[model samples]
Target: MAVLFSVIPLLLIALAVYGAVVVLRRSRQVSSAWSSGITAQARCVRSYTTTNRSGDSMVRTTLHHVYEFTTRDGRVIRFDETDGPSTRIEGDIVTVHYLPVRPELATAKVPAPGKLAASTGCALLFLTVFIAFAIFLIVVANSDSMR
Candidate 1:
């Protein structure tokens, strides 16, 4: 039983590490992939209305666009914007940063510089919370072992 308790915290730490790695990797992939910027006008924007099990509605958005581009690695990503609120905008002048390898995949869109930074900060904040929680669990479990 003690072994199981000890293992559980380690497992949580592992999971936390995995989550952090995934987020950081993705962030890096997106940052590195962003190649060029374009003057894209918003084509369409719509907010989503999601219903949960308890019948509550959640608001989300889906943005679309039509544009052209070249990749940094000569991937030739083309066509419209297909990402929503958090990542894309339509009918507005957007500076799109795309991956060089896959011209089709854009790493990010900064609607406004300030907002993008805020979004990145929020993601990092959540990552910190998860990691801290994982450490706390390990510490508590280890202390219990001494008694």
Candidate 2:
């Protein structure tokens, strides 16, 4: 029982660290792309909607947008924006930011600087909480063993 309890907290901390790393890396990639990538105008070609049933039996629909753009080199690429649907129309033009080396890795919009920083901070905060609780657990287990 003690071993299980100890392992659980460690596992949680490990998972938190892994998640934080992934988010930070992604944010870094996007930030770098924005600074070093080529910008072009992409058009919303079409969208697909999916209906899902919520936990309360309410039906909800989500829209996935598909956009296409031509790179600076005149190559065309199409990608689906998984960040949910926007209010854009089929003919609406949107700015696309893509890395020159990896054109497929692109985003229609970049998040605010504060937003990205806040995400990293939130992940680290959760990690701090997990570490604190894990330390508390270890101390209690040690005290119990001594008794």
**TM-score winner among the candidates?**
2
Residues 62-113, model 2: lDDT tens digits: 7777889999999898887655446766877888888877777677765467
On the 0 to 100 scale, the lDDT of residue 123 in model 1 is: 77
Question: Candidate 2: deviation at residue 41, Å?
Answer: 1.4
Quantify all predictions' global Cα lDDT against the true fold.
Answer: 0.54, 0.77
lDDT tens string, model 1, 46-137?
Answer: 32333335336654544455544444444444455435454433444444565444545553355354554476678778877876886777
Off by over 4 Å in 2: 46-64, 89-91
Instruction: Choose the strongest candidate by lDDT.
Output: 2
